[model samples]
Target chain A: MNHAWNVTRMHLRYNSIWLYMPLIVLFSSFFINLIIAVLSDVPIYTGGVASVYLFMLITGLLTLRNTFSFAIGFSFRRKDYFFGTFLMVAFVSFSTTVLLALLSYVENNLTNAWGNELYFFHLPYLNDGNVVIQACVIFSLMFHLYYLGFSISSVHRRFGRYGMMILLIVSLVAGSLISAIITYFHWWQIIFTKVIAYSAFQLSWGIGLLTIFFILVSYFMLRRATS
Target chain B: MGQILEINGLTKAYKDVTSIYQMSFTLKENKIYGLLGRNGAGKTTLMHMITAQLFPTCGDVKVFGEEPYENTRVLQQICFIKESQAYPEYFQISDVFATAKSIYPNWNDGLANQLTQDFQLPLNRRIKELSRGMLSSVGIVVGLASRAPLTIFDEPYLGLDAVARGIFYDRLIEDYAEYPRTVILSTHLIDEVSQLLEHVLIIERGELLFYEDAESLRSRIYSVSGSSEVVETYMKGKEVIHVEKIGSLVTVTLLGKKEENNKKQAESLGLEYVPISLQKFVVDLTTKSREKVVKGQ
Candidate 1:
């Protein structure tokens, strides 16, 4: 069997949970969207569509963190692992985006007719007939997450759970302190806030860029592991 | 005998603690070698190094005169059956067989299915869902069916009942007779596999203590028992492996072959002779006097 295909088949068969993850994210968004729709007395069309990206971001974070363990956990070649993961995440993220977009279209029409109701409209992440490329982009995005997860997990296997939590707390505390100092200083508050927000945005974009670099690093670790 | 695998001062260390010392040995083709060692004696570590699952801290290992690491040509010909094989959680028995068929060039599906039926392993159940014994059966099945040139079984009888283990032994011997490949059996059950092993390698404290043919291994040491004076007289000028004294009666293990008239001489001198079983010989060889030497030097 082709090693990549074998690995991909194994992933699909054993880990259908990854494919269904988007649904979990979608549904979570749905409930949150429903709550906002009811409270604000507005149609679920726009809010629900925007929520898809939020769902993608959340799912992407989780998907990135665990990508490495599942990718190269066994005796499969490291390259095959990377490719197999790339294929699986790409298929999943793109499928979710399309489904959400179709759902949003239905939502927009329903809202116009019924004043305030939960329905779907085209999500912002969808591209016109470029599903393949879109999926690849999503895959690259998640692959970055996988690299981060694998690197951190390698340094400390226990890092995924409590280590991540501790990291989260520390980052939060640092950000809050920094934010407070900027607010008190007042001189550069506007500039500081924009820089902070841009940095966060850049951080998200940087994940995809760093994923390529990490893939090579991950290969090195994998080579070490096999030996 | 032509050596299929050779080790030259191989050592593997984890941080400060050394798991395997600068050990060296040669494994010949088409022979069954017993790797006899107690727990924490570096048996698994040595096997892992040979199979390229680990890197040696120093020294070298050659399989078929080539390095085994990531060399698919060499790897495809070797099978290392871990004591407790780990399978993907959702992979069924069939998946493992299929994966083995794909990875190993010589994998025989027919042999795999046969072993699966003989072991009564279910094909549909996920690996994780199977019982411990069933998991062990799966490992054995893969090891056998792969039909690799150099097959290493490391404590493969862990969760198997005695009957299943007996079946494994019988099948192994039967298959081995027909196939004639190199087999390395690493197990604690010395008595059970004593007959199957043609050669034995006894290790102690990460060091190779003895490596010799099993048939002649017994001739290297002989036990003599009689009155303390008689036994001591018989053992004079000979290498004495062990000596036990019970009142006037004494038993002495001497390192030498018994002559045709040696038994008659013992009888004439009021001494008794007993043949040492392979298990007793290995136990005495691996354990006795080695700990003190290791501690001191």
Candidate 2:
């Protein structure tokens, strides 16, 4: 257990860019929006918080190739690396969610959206529920994205780049086929209405289940991954 | 005196190509072993399997009497340094040492620091910026300072100069004598490391060719040169691994136990008998095995 934590610490030291880049993008986006609002005399609505999730997702992919291989070279078992990476990802997601929630609270209650109606953290349809529910939605979605990236990287590691390319093409064809079928049946409107019918909590729980599925897939793929 | 590693029928195959085929060996504690082989002879594959970095297609690798796959109990006792080991791009040399300190329970800070100074490794420079020789030096320092019970170096000094390589060997021998442990060094520089090896494991075309004590193996094979007729008559019914001819002179390398009677007979027969070095012996052995493989193909 101590060794696993040490591996995690080592990963955190090497990949700290993933944790800080999100905040950098967030603040940069906020300041740019603030300046635009002040100069143009107009309201700025942004969903820059999504950048944090995007960065984390990319980090998930990069770390598997970089840090995971290095850790294995250092004599860490695949299980220890998986556990350590999971701990790091979970901690980053939880902490980022809390930070985003606090910023949302301050934006909505204190600064009045930066006094120019600049909506960054408190976006509509996503933050329409209690703070805890909003945090859950963001956290689950972030985890889902991260695991999706992690699973793809694991596939690339276990199987080669050709396997990942084949997977991409297959997924694209499957998605296109599904979209074509839906379009032929004229069911896009019904799908959208059904999607909007679910509450934020229910949607988050559904995505949470998908995240678990991705996590399991990533674990199996990673188990067979070699340096 | 106890066995540190026991491998049984270990095989690794990729698609239709087998890198290692049903190899088995046992490594005793507190001894330096030389895993000598030509390129693509499965030395790295065997080391990878023992370290649990690469999985075997079939068979078992036991370290400290337990399966080493994903077992931290076994992994913590072993340190494998390869020529192609990757490092995180964001790390400095100091960060690597720090992480090694945390991972290896018996890490020696004093030794690490001393080696850092000896190797002249820049602690604050990113690993990406280091030259290839510097990178190898880092591996040597880590392998030496970690003090793991089982340390394996698979061609860990690829880009090191002769002076640096000598320093590494000297430091390795000095440290090892003070703190005895099992060490396996896999390299193609058989002559350079021949004196350092207590045991020799020679692999040819992914198969075990010989495993014996270094000193005994050195004495087992020898070459004799003389008149063609005299050498041919003397070489009758003996295992001749290699032969060379110059004009009317013939040189044949024989593989057998050294006996006083045989030496006396060769001397009395007007044949010049010369002992073959480990390097020459391995070259002869691998070349013969490769020719046999080609003939079979």
Candidate 3:
């Protein structure tokens, strides 16, 4: 196959960098908390809002689906297209993950020396290092698959505006339905439906399953797009 | 002369609306051929089919004796410059050059860079951010520098100012002279490229109207100008393709041999026989053919 890496490289240089905004905002929020601890003589390990930072991680990845789809040759082989996008996302994620870890490490040490009991969550402790890593990996892939597939299906057609509107409506409806289903269904007897709704494990599973389903659905829709 | 491109009964229809119908034409190597038609006359459609960007609904298109669709050997030897070439929002002018250099094996980077400077295209500016004229310049530069055996320019000079367009035409002719190849220029700017065209292909409403040498086309239709009454009387029992009336002056485009009798009759009636510009002749021919179709329908 005639690979156009130069073209792909330019695409990532400009668009892929935007995908890291969530990590940037997350690190900035942490840095702010660290600064406050420094001024108040409090420890850096003290907990802050986990939900805001996690939400940033999820939405940032989701929003990037459009840019990734646009940049990569999604019209070509689906495997290669998805692989290219996954590689870029993985690279960005790894870089940001390392950066955040270092920042947290320095803050934790500073606060510990000051004798303030500050609590910092390392990525490895997000819930069994392997589990969180698996969750993040699966979550990123699934989220990307679903968003890319849905957008490619609906964008650029005679009823493109209507298609996009319908896609948005369907995605929102699907997301709510999943949330509602999880709200009703208990998992493993130990975790209640509401508890699963609040837990990161369920979030990772939901995203992974949804992404796999989306990939299958998108391949079908792509026949129409490419036809 | 060896046949560089052969399009056999090429038919392209979208949803039963035929854009090109059973069109067959062969382009000889080292000749500049003009693909002429009014807008929606299927000129661009034929070009697209030839370039393998659009597959023909029926018939075949061959470049260098092979199918062009996904046949890299054929495609590599062909450069298709669309009127508005779409690029990603992030792709800079230099990115286009970089991609073209790889895509077209015959791509001359030195020439491409030179054209960039001549066209005054900012190498770092994204393609989407460029002005319409600049975008066209970038396309022209690629089309020319690619130096493909089968080069096609489908109205590639749109939105370019007259001076810049002149530069393009001059550079194209100069380069083409130094290195001859099969060049198919599809444009509404017929008069501008008339001198450069060795042959002409006229399409009228999805059908190939005429395909002949440009010299023969000029000889095929001769304009007879005189008083309306006298010219109309002389034009009887003759094939008059187009008739233009300006006040009392009647210019009848006669499509037959310029016999001595017809000339004498025109001379006796104080008429003048003027050579029709290739552009005007082609416009009249296609327009007249279209009028006949409309009248028949």
Candidate 4:
């Protein structure tokens, strides 16, 4: 357990990737949206904020490739690496989500989208309900996307390229099969109606459960991964 | 001294190939061992198993008398610097040093800094930007400075020039003298590292061929050259690994530590005893075994 912190510290050494780039990408996207919204006559309700969330998912995948093989061969137990990476990702997810939540509050309540009426952060369904629930929505979504990428990369690491290729084919086949079944039954209307009716707080709980599932899977896959 | 490592009947097999097969050996504490073998002789596979980076398909490895797979007590004490050591794309040499300081319990920053200067490594350069030799220098620095109980270097100086390699050897000998610990160096450059090696382990075709002190291994074989008839007579009933003939002169490389009668017999027959080098001995040993395989097939 004590050595696990060492592993976490090691991962944190790449601050440029984990901390600086994400912030840079987020703010860059915001400025671009802000400029276009200020010039337009009508109010802007663009989804530019999704770019930052997309980058967060990429971080989860990049972290494994950049660090997993290196650390495992450096005399660190696989469990130590898993725990350390978990702590680092969890901390980053929570803090980044909180920041996003604060930005949403300011855009909605304080500055009214910086007076340009640019609706980037406080989207309709995502920013629903009270402040605490609003933060949970972003946190849960960010956590889930991050771990989803993480779990996929772990599968790649534990298994070789052939295993990863086979897994990807299987996942594509299964995904298409499920969508075909849903379309045949016209379940999209039924599913979205039930899903859209749920409050932001309830949806956060569902995404949070999926986040936990991915974290558990990544742990097991990484525990047995070799250098 | 106590046992530092023990392997019993270890084997590793892939779909259609076996990297290591039924190999076994024991290493004592505080000694330098040379893991010498040809390129595909399973030297790296054996080292990977010792460091717990790869699983043994048929046997077990005990480092300090405990399994190293996820055992921090054992893992933390073993530092393996492989030929293909990977680093993060964005990591600088300084970052590697900092991380090494955190992971290795016995890490010596002073030695690390000195080696950094000795090897002339650019601390701020990204590892990916460095040349191949510079990258190898990084591995050498970390391997020496980490000072783990069991430090294994598997061809750590792949692209390093002779001068840089000399620095590595000098620093290794100096640090090892002050701090006694187990070191296993795996490389095909037997001639360069032969003098520094105390014990030797030879692997060929996924099996252990020889495990003995360096002195005995050196004297284990010698050659005799003279008239073809006299040399042929001298080689009778002896273990001859290789034989060559040029004109009327015949040379036979035999296996037996410089025995008294062996040299006396050569002298009486007007034959000369030619001392073979460690590198030549290994080449002959492995090539002989390979020829055996080819003939068998």
Candidate 5:
């Protein structure tokens, strides 16, 4: 009877189209690649799963813009709304992660890339870890990207168009400034060395922390947002 | 009936404009309140403050005797439907109703179904694809069927035709009588909804002008017109609320004791009595306040 759960239901009802689309796109691309791999007799390595992660990001960006106002009109508490959105996205990420893990297993061992050497689901570095670790890495990556989008969306919700504009300009300036400084100081070598030293499992723990940060920041901003 | 809502010294100020000035009012349970005001008079701002959607610059708002902001216990018992209520872009009318059904604990599926038919809405159609009037009907259906203990509708019938508006009023009254609740309706069609309102709250330029029973509001004002000189003479030592002059033919509304003999006295003095309606009174009041603001500036 918690209205937070009701908010999750509300989101789930409208999310069907966006929900299944990434999977559909992934599978379609997989089959098409399978056809090409069979004909050419060449090893096919692809980033087809990238579409699934990017789609989650888009869903996060749309979450508040589409539903927050409507839910508030229906008398939902802000906290409940955020809680529901959180639950819904978490459910989506977990499902996506599980499916990717299963497909990766099939490509690696079960069918040997569907008998045609098509490495669509199993990327080398990403799947280097054990099955549990690989699933964790994928889940962390998808969940983190979704929350990153949600956090950005919440800024607009709380602060309006000007807020988004200011954020964009600031991000661009900061990104350029950081890139310039890093190049001038020749820091890329050190950064790359440290980054490459960490295993994918280790990297996912960092992503897990960043995902929590995005979730918290989004909730704080959306708390004061109006319809 | 207990007090369903109580607001004290509420105000919302933006960087340059004050949306609602210091305002205070207590609303009793199970009465339909008419939140009457001209456009930009802060009626919507006040309602948003009451529902805890918009934070006030300063004041207290208690719904069901508790602070409403972020309070689930208080929020779940309230339903707020507005003219520009948003829906998910991909939603159909049926999808909207399904979400509403899940959100509202007191939701009436039978009434929702009946209203969907009464409004002649194609539930399968995407909400964005519906006509403006159909969208209004969707809000009306949800507001009526929610049956929340405290329901607020801010201009709930925009773009609706006369027949559809009549159906709204009829359904509102019928549903309200069957299941009594505190309803606050803000609208510009004052005359149409005058009879439905038990109490009237008039806001002028972010300030509370009138907060009283409907009958008292009607009985407290009467209008008369004559030449500028005679009307001025009659207005001496009298509390006047509104006046209009057309080439020295003067009309003035007096705010004083309601009396049967006042009309007779006006006629005897060669002044024409203009029957004042609730709508006229509200319009005259807001116009007069606008003049006051203009003069002050």
Candidate 6:
């Protein structure tokens, strides 16, 4: 366990750039939104600030691709690497969630959406809840996206580029098949109604479950991967 | 000394290709071992298995009386340096050293700094910007300074000049003597490391070819040159590994210690006997094996 923590610290040191990227993106987007609000007399909506979340997602892929082999070279066990990576991802996600929540609180209460009714950190359905709920939604979404990247990278590591391509193709085909079945059964309307009925907290919790599933699959992939 | 590593029926197969097959050996503590083999001869595969970087298809590898796979207790004592070790793109040499210091329990900061000076490696240079020789020097510094009980170097001097390689060897030998730990040096440049090795393990075509004390192996193989007819007569009933002829002159390498009577006989027969170097002996042996395989096919 100590070794695993050491591996985590190593990852934190080497890949610290990725950890700070979301904050950089958030601040840059905020500045851009502020500039547009000052120039124009209209309300500016900066909902696209979720780009920071996308950056967080990509960080997962880069971490596994770049550091997995290196950790193995240093004689870290596959399990240790996986757990260490999980710890790093969790830490980064939680920190990003808290920062985003704080920014949203400031935007809604302090700056009043940058004094021009901007919606940078505060989205419609995403932040229409208490502070804990807002943080949960962000954390769950970030975790899900990050683990999706992790699962893909784990597949690439274990099976190579060809394997990743095959996986993508298979997933696309399976998705199309499911969509076809849903259309044939005329279930789209029902599915959409059910999805709309679910509250943000419930939906985010479901996505959190998906993140756990991806984490499990990634572990299996990493077990068979070689440096 | 106790055995530091023990292997039994170790094998690693990838699909249809077996990189190592039914190999077994014991490494005693506090001795330098030379793992000598050609490319594709399974030396790297064996090292990876011992370090728990790769799994064996079938076999058991015990380091410090326990399996090394995922066992931090065993792995913490091992430091494996390879030609292709990767560092994070953003890491400078100093970052790498700091990370190594944290992971390895016995890492020596003073020794690492001393080696950085000896190898003239810049601490602030990003890993991606360093030249290949400098990268190799970084590995050497880490391997020596980590001071792990079992240190393995697999072709660790790629792109290094002769001077840098000499510094590596000198530092390795000096630190190893003071620390008294097991070291495995695997390289294609066999002659350069021959003097540093106490025991030698030779692998050929996924099989163990020979494992013995280096001195014993040196005495076991020798070459003789003379007239074709005389050399042929003298080499009869001996285990001849290689034979070459230029016009009427013939040279043959045989496996056996040179007895006094055999030398006397060769002298009387106008044959000149020469001791074969380890590098030449390995090359000749591997060449002969390859030829035999081609002929068999």
Candidate 4 clash pair list: none
Model 5 chain A lDDT-worst window of ten:
A12-21
**Candidate 2 — what's its lDDT?**
0.88
Instruction: Itemize residue pairs with steric clashes in candidate 2.
Output: none
TM-score of the A chain in candidate 2: the value is: 0.94
The local distance difference test score of each candidate is 0.70, 0.88, 0.68, 0.88, 0.89, 0.88
Ranked candidates, highest DockQ first: 4, 2, 5, 6, 1, 3
Candidate 6's displacement at residue B149, Å, is 1.0
**Where's the lowest-lDDT run of ten residues in candidate 2 chain B?**
B256-265
In model 6, where do residues sit more than 4 Å from their true spots?
Answer: B258-262
Check candidate 3 and list the clashing pairs.
A45-A118, A45-A119, A46-A118, A46-A119
In order of appearance, the predictions have TM-scores of 0.79, 0.96, 0.75, 0.97, 0.97, 0.97
Tell me how each candidate scores on DockQ against the true complex.
0.24, 0.81, 0.15, 0.84, 0.81, 0.75
lDDT of 1 by residue, B210-231 (tens): 7888887766656789888778
Interface Cα RMSD for all candidates? 4.5, 1.0, 6.0, 0.8, 1.0, 1.2
Root-mean-square deviation (CA) per prediction: 5.2, 1.7, 5.5, 1.5, 1.6, 1.5
- Candidate 3 residue spans exceeding 4 A from truth: A13-128, A131-227, B1-4, B15-17, B55-60, B65-67, B228-230, B257-270, B293-297
Model 1 root-mean-square deviation: 5.2
Q: Give the 10-residue window scoring lowest on summed lDDT in candidate 3 chain B.
A: B256-265
For candidate 5, lDDT tens digit of each residue in A1-227? 38889898888787665577887888898888889999987798988889898898898998888899998988889999999888888898898899999889988979988898899988888887778889999999999999999999999999999999999999999999999999999999999999999999899999999999999999999899988
Tell how far residue A95 is off in model 5, in angstroms.
1.0
Worst 10 residues of 6 chain A by lDDT: A14-23
TM-score of candidate 5 to 2 decimals: 0.97
Q: Which residue window of length 10 is worst by lDDT in model 4 chain B?
A: B257-266
Query: Per-residue lDDT for A129-149 in model 1, tens only?
Result: 344444444444544654565
Model 5 misplacement above 4 A: none
